[model samples]
Target: MLIKECKGFELEKEKSNTSEDFFNRSEVTFIENGEEKTLHVLYVRYFDEILQEFTPYSQDPILADQGLDVTFKDIVALVCLLKNPGLRGRKRLYINSKHDFAAYFQDIDFSKLPEVFQSLKQKNSYELRSPLEFILQPK
Candidate 1:
């Protein structure tokens, strides 16, 4: 499926130049179950102490054969934010089925990302109220 629109946000106001940890906050809209649904996605790159390298991560589970064809084990990381009626002015952010607010590294094909994401390095945050095409599947 193709993401019809994508908008990004930066969680942190102050960035540390020395720190290698960074993450992308984006809202992706796609057609699901014959209706349009928007998913909040977070693609993170963090410094791994044990590996001594920057690792990619997401705080949510990538369900296989559901939204995308990829399996959970095939990913580097994922996070999904959903609305919770009980929480006031707060959304539930899931790091996967097992953990909440926890993060782990996952591998994602950088080539498949949209140009908006590719240009993220130049600007830390951006909000574009326009239509954009982002393909998750490899062409």
Candidate 2:
């Protein structure tokens, strides 16, 4: 059976590489089927001169599936979680062709992700660490 959704997500911001222009890099841990699986996430931010605020240019998920247990539904859930719907115009979420979803995203069923996200969000124990705490904590 496919792993349709995770129990929850943990976003721990990773240290930025000075050579890269990324806004935030995170180690996103997905609590799925009583196991903690992780994926690397990178976000590119562009300063909007008119809005006077930083906005996401793109978001990417790096899944090293060598020994990792993940599914296409997890990819859908990840996309639904990371893709900022609040953005007005262009699509900023990017997933490379290596992952399973990259090849069959259009064909895959994504109906269950929304409900999973709602359930995950409503849980009181879920917490995302601040940047400061991320820096202080050992990897």
Task: Work out the TM-score per prediction.
Answer: 0.32, 0.30
Q: What CA root-mean-square deviation does each model show from the true structure? A: 12.5, 16.7
lDDT of model 2 at position 104? 25
Whole-model lDDT values for every prediction = 0.32, 0.32
Worst 10-residue lDDT window, candidate 2 = 47-56
lDDT per residue for candidate 2 within 55-119, as digits (tens), equals: 11122222223333332223433443334222212223333333422332332233433343444
Candidate 2 off by > 4 Å: 1-17, 22-27, 32-35, 43-101, 124-139
Q: lDDT of model 2 at residue 10?
A: 33
Q: Which stretches of candidate 1 lie over 4 Å from their true place?
A: 11-24, 41-105, 114-139
| Tens-digit lDDT track of model 1 for 1-139 | 2234445443464656632235435554544345655555454433112222222323222222223333222222211221221221232232322222232222223333333333332343223222222113355
